[model samples]
Target: MTLPDGGQSPDALRSGTGGGSWDGERSGRGLSEREPFDLLVTGGRVIDPASGRDEIAAVGIRAGSIAYVGPVPDRAAAYSRRTIDATGQVVAPGFIDLHSHAQTISGGRLQALDGVTTALELEGGALPVADHYRYAEDQGRVINFGMSASWSSARMCVLDQAPAVRPQDDPRFRLPLAMFDQFQNGPRWQSAADDAQESKIVGLVERQIAAGAIGIGVLQGYAPGSRLSEQHLLGRLAEQVGQPLFVHARSMAPAGPGNAVDAAHELIDTAELTGAHVHLCHLNSTSGRRADRVTTDWATAQRSGLRLTAEAYPFHAGSTVIGAAFLDPEVLARDGISTRSVIYLATGERVADADRLLELRETDPGALCILETFDLDDPQQLALLLTAVTFGDAAIASDAMPLTYTGPAPRSGTDHSERALAALTGDVWPLPDGLIAHLRTSGCFARALRWLVRDLGVLDLVEVIRRCTILPATILAAAAPAMQRKGRLSVGADADLTIFDPDRVQPAGDYTRLAPSIGFSHVIVAGTPVVDGGDLVPDAFPGRAIRGSAG
Candidate 1:
């Protein structure tokens, strides 16, 4: 829709028309020799959503930023150390995930394979901001990473309850099974904050923001008992710091107090009252068939100067901890779903009734379950809801859950001993079949590209790229300065790019089998190739911390 200024237009960029000539002198080239470049990507259909550029071009990188983007120079081969021939591929800015929960190494690697270069946990951020960043850095992330200050985690921390996970709590920096379980069946999920507890929660939030959180992650849905006043206070704190408030709204029920519409209004009203920028996570899952109505409300809020945005994944069924209170029979009835619709990620079996749900909750409190809340079985209804969110300009996010290993460990003296040793020491192992049971963790972005752009044709290629790149970047840049130079293909922008075969790019996995997508030929993060020729580059850790202004 709105093209970014000072960037090439789609036609000009694609067709190489009506732009400056190849100015070698201006690009630091001498008469006899071209300036050396660290990497050169040649002969690709460069689609820069920010500039509306979609032309064949060559890109040059120096250090970790784009140094040149234009016609390939005659001496380019001689001046560059690495060259990737990108013919027949679409070279675009790497996708930026706004609400990813894939913070672990296995998760990050999966995201890289999906063409993501920057993945942030904004929906439910980490408790200790410093530790979240430090752990990712110390453990060697495969993509740029960051997080917001989690109001939910802060509330649990102040209550002195053991959270499902804590930032850097483990020596190996692993996501604890405790974190996912705590939100479902504990006091943290059931209790409402009083005056003293509310004040302490607010204090923790402020401290986290001061420690470099990009914004405040408010997951009120997990704790329905949390008072609106407590949320309002969190909004005020975010507003005071000029940071956005990323929220997973209170409920997904179709009727009653905690319905999706009421949940949206809660955040909209809070943002209006506190002047805080608020982003709703996973609107498709939360609002279901009523997503269009919710989008209308968000648009109305924006008209009134309430800064509101929302995101959605491509899938219809949404996953969460099995023991979440919202899964209670009364709530599920209000939401119009049943236990029969509940699919357990660990077993891939649909819970047959209340008895089965209770059995799973009692036996496996930490297991993740998928609720078939939307019209996933109907193609037309699915397309309509998907189109509604994209029509509203909602950004795409995976809400990717972390992949965990529960199988037997590798033997000490086997041929796979090295792999076993790494797994033992690194707190990670090959993802079990159950871990990749859902496509959301590994195929969300690619699925969005396939379903929205290639299949339904709801959006053109450039528009989809904009939503995944510049749109999310623009939203975060208001609070996180580190994002300003990202999500674009202009000179001086970070050399994070995803080169894929647009014709072949599609999600490969489904509810039955989990697999990574194909066609992502190259994924570059900060000038280093993390995924080369459709395979992950072993031991590559070019990702850096994306801190906020507070840091």
Candidate 2:
């Protein structure tokens, strides 16, 4: 092992830093230099928010790890043997959507089309994250993907029923039994439900973590019965695992018992108390506080740094299942919400198939309230979007309207397919199909991004790209580790990249239910192009499940 002339022998040099780390598990030891690279993405804008670099750069890929990132100096330099001409296009890391239900429910191929490289399924919106992650990995997903252990889904899966009150607080757990007659009167359900709630849920979270869930998703609105203690428990578990907690506030209903502002404050305080990295989901809703009010509350909370962040869709309207729309109007009086603030996203005027709507209300109430007005006027949306274009890592999401369910062949007797489909997805407010279709199309994200580069003129292209790339990656890492490597286009970064002609690039927003946003040119994932020249390239899934190393 001794050096001959001051330097080690060639064999030693080659053996020391070139082996034993290909799998990347070395107890804090870094990777060596000789692993076979999987792919390389070269010649792109490389808007790396992490390194504060936004210029022409090349990324080297080896063994599925980024081996180098920086100006290539020369394409002939001693860097990557492989390269991609991302010149005149964006080479920043892939886009990450934090709470996208569409990610798994839509088969994820759709999200890949939208240039979303990493999709984090959260709360109750998607299937159990572990199962979905496994499916993705088996397919060798072309886009990076992760999941959060959904609190609502977790509890529901455990209890196999929803509660009416915050049951965790009561020592007896009797309050829910008294409040929800169904839980009380059901057939031998209470005891079984209780056991399922306590033991199965804990086991489920652990299993998801073992299966590579990045963090936990907490959607309180979806689990109205989840008490403060239940949320605290979820936070504690996530904190123990060093994962992020995605929170969709419980009472952000336009007609709810608490103002949206109050909900925001509540989340901030909960985060402060629980010591969890709290990501507030969907900043605007009819039940959300007024835009001006939310601005003040969010500013103050963010300044305090309760590890808080929020996401917003670019459109003027918000969408959800109709059952949420039918949340007791009396709650408006309790929460001091103004009914005028709410506008139906899907439901409008006459109820679609009155009988169907009634049945949906009783059994599967959350059919479709597709879109509605809540917070942030069009002007405010423009301001936020404009600001984000320049400042990277704002954590923006498409929040595209996605179908929740594709049920079995409709009964031959069914007339309105949309209504029947809506029932399957939990839509109760069945409105006209033509009435609220805009919120579901690509025009939403395009229009939002457009207001920035064109009308507002707030940010240059570099800054806008950074926000979408690096900034979001950083924010997501604050909550989930999978997003950390995803937002960069440098050496050792993932090969997920997007290249589009700036001049020719345009948002193709056509509100057709049949096909939406089907055009994206050259979507490269993991150093492979999935979409070329605005068309899908088959047999091109290069994605994989990203594991969280923090825990």
Candidate 3:
């Protein structure tokens, strides 16, 4: 894993041109001398997938945007007030996560360590989109954050008679994940909406878009009983508004209309019927062992010009609430998922039998759990898991879950909701003890680089960078114009960039432990260093809202 130039020092590289000292006082003749840049990064292999640049270069930031990107003199710091030595590292556009659910301050810190600058909750988005943004702005997020308008949230409000907005003091009101508890077993979960209810849900989603939601988040899997007519209506709405529908396709049951392939068709068919752009969320976990077949079908459809896109994470396991409809024994057995594969996060215990799984789901439906969908140790199973990830043009997104602390008591029922709610709104950094979440929250991007690029050699550095950066930016840029300036290293683009040692960047945690990744030298958001020199800047809050044009 030697870097370009055989691990030589930055000074050695500079000496080739007989440059000045490494202290960075000398300026290159090619550089401009108008105003000093706010920040500068030197001696890194700059890879901009958007443009085909993969060479040693320097980047200068000014006023929250990229001011310069070119060769620098030995004294690169002469161009900026603050400088970062990115020698032996890769400087690329900051990773964009299209499926993150970890919207809290502590959660964003963990993601920053993994090289992510923008993390959006597009799969299970919030109900009152404006409220979600307002709360995030008030709290001052560490990384950029945004969300879609949630179809599930709208349905619950209409069918379950739930309030559209709760009091400001109630932290659960703004956190979309809390809906898994507050309305987990509500009638909306298993009931199909009538004509009037469907019209009302459509109205609510439209209002959310007008409030600046980037798109529509359809958690179709949670409400498996939802009628196709409702999906058609929603797709039409998204098409009319020129926005995409981020959908979690229905259950992965092995047979019937709810099977994985059928679920894929549900989205494709809607797109064809309504001309709506559809973005599939977590194709790897939802497709299970059929990832290869599903990915191939998607590729074929993409060739035919249906407005479709997808994303995948590197891990074989997935995290979700215990009561997800797809986790039922009948559905699991049909899809080859055994009860033993499910592990309760509170107790860190594998479900012993169907009885235990049912009991847990009944008692604590909102509790978080991990399900190993593929046996990564087995070569054949591992290949199937990689199929979706390596598929052409697919973004690498972390379906990162929110963090929760299970105190010593580990209470169920109302107590569990209280603990989960507290974890979502807590401002404590360095995360209090007993907090646990899926490793993907902190390691998704690093693991993708380690396994897919370095270890397996399945993808090259530039290609992976394309998937992590520009591809996602392209997917949303049509609706959110601000994204047009992100995911690129050219001058005038946003200065949200990630610099990391490619040779050493890897996941620092496993199934049994949770820790932030290592080897990330710096992570900048809007020209501010949120993670600098491999450490989080405690008070940095440069994250800003990313909204759609409909507002």
lDDT of 1 by residue, 404-444 (tens): 33334555564354443344225344433434435787888
Give lDDT tens digits, candidate 3, residues 58-156. Answer: 888889987677776666666678888888999999999999989888889999999999999888888778877988898889999888988898988
Q: 404-481 in candidate 2: lDDT tens per residue?
A: 333344456644555655432222332223322333333333343455555566655565555556655666554454
Alpha-carbon local distance difference test for all models: 0.76, 0.51, 0.83
Given candidate 2, what's the lDDT at residue 410? 48
TM-score: model 2 vs. ground truth: 0.70
Off by over 4 Å in 2: 1-44, 57-84, 105-107, 125-129, 161-207, 253-257, 286-289, 325-360, 363-369, 374-393, 404-448, 458-460, 478-481, 510-520
* Clashes per model (N, Cα, C within 3 A): 7, 29, 1
* TM-score of each model, paired residue for residue: 0.90, 0.70, 0.91
Sort the predicted structures by lDDT, highest score first: 3, 1, 2
True lDDT of residue 274, candidate 3: 94
lDDT of 1: 0.76
Which runs of model 1 end up more than 4 angstroms from their true locations?
Answer: 1-34, 163-173, 176-183, 406-434
Provide the lDDT at 258 for model 1: 62
